[model samples]
Target: MDDNLIFAVIGAGNTGQAMAGYLKLKGFAVRLYDRSEWRFKSLRKHSMRLSDEIVSSQKIDLLTTNLNEAVHGANFIIVSTSTTAHIEIAKRLSEILTNDQTILLHPGRTGGALIFKKILRENRPDLKITIGEFESSIFTTRVSATGSTVHYYGIKNGVHFSTLPAVDVRKIFQILKIYFLKLRPIRMCSTLL
Candidate 1:
């Protein structure tokens, strides 16, 4: 378990920042990414706010504006942005995603996962990548009063996750349980209906 597994959070928004900080707090290697370089400056601000909660000097492994740098070597990439941008993000990811990487929308909208998976398949027929989506964001989050720290308001239980290639459910769950203890794998067939 000590093998440095990299977790990349692909947005710098409230949900993404909190997720990344909490993951870093939990001792996982984390990389934070946003298209804007200015958003990358969040670490210096978040680290201080999370200091009391984490009780240790946990910090994100890297922060970058380049998507390629963010996803490279990341075992799992969480697309924490709003579902509105899933298509655009999917297009970008299809271009550089490696075969070994797995990506999932933090909170999937109707048919969002399938749409994303379809794009990946069409673009990279040569690669077998795992894709999935959560029923909703695991953490209800917002920036703190200080305006730098992401404050998690709540954790909803029984949150469902549906992955592509239904057979990979167990494998994907094993990966997610490491950080998101609240996730429960549900039938992809059932969710589609």
Candidate 2:
């Protein structure tokens, strides 16, 4: 794994927190952001903890309430926010993201990738976008917060990803494999859903 890889997870809810925790355990520098001040404050009180299987004391960098600060320069941006905010967030990111950056959507459902593609095409078509699925939310095993400690129950395997043009599948696979050792790439036939 590349120690230089930086991951920013937006949403800081269960899924976001879990991703940040797991990546941190894997030795990646992770930043977490959420719109909820309450959750942010809660996390602040108790730093996140990874499952027992992995050993690490790395704390996640919290970028609460500031979307741009969380995402602007990240090599990999994982959107774990609710589906309702997906389009709006993607639209905003289209203006700031560069072609080399990747956006991975967790638990993508009902045309989520299509929606992002639509907004990006209409706005910054030149920018590159990649979408993926992480089986389900990363914290599925078990997660509970008390004071400043967020505890996790388990971690799973295999994250699937695909690039917008499909031709860049290899590149996407290469980047994702660094953070997720078990990533599987699937090629899509069309850009439209």
Query: Against the true structure, what is every candidate's RMSD?
Result: 2.6, 2.5
What lDDT score belongs to each candidate, Candidate 1 first?
0.78, 0.71
Q: Candidate 1: where are CA atoms >4 Å away?
A: 42-48, 51-57, 145-147, 190-193
Error of 1 at 181 (Å): 2.1
Cα lDDT of model 2 overall?
Answer: 0.71
Indicate the residue-level lDDT of 58 in model 2: 54
lDDT of 2 by residue, 1-193 (tens): 4578888898777777777878877777788877777776656665665555554455676556787888877888888888899888888888778777777787664567777878888999677666554445545534454424445655556555565666777877776676666667777667354
**TM-score of each predicted structure versus truth:** 0.88, 0.84
Tens-digit per-residue lDDT, 60-89, candidate 1: 778888899999888889999978888889
Residue 103's lDDT within candidate 2 is 77
RMSD of 1: 2.6
In angstroms, what RMSD does candidate 2 have relative to the true structure? Answer: 2.5
Give me the runs in candidate 2 sitting further than 4 Å from their true place: 52-56, 133-135, 145-151, 157-159, 191-193
On lDDT, the leading prediction is: 1
Pick out the ten consecutive residues of candidate 1 with the lowest summed lDDT: 48-57
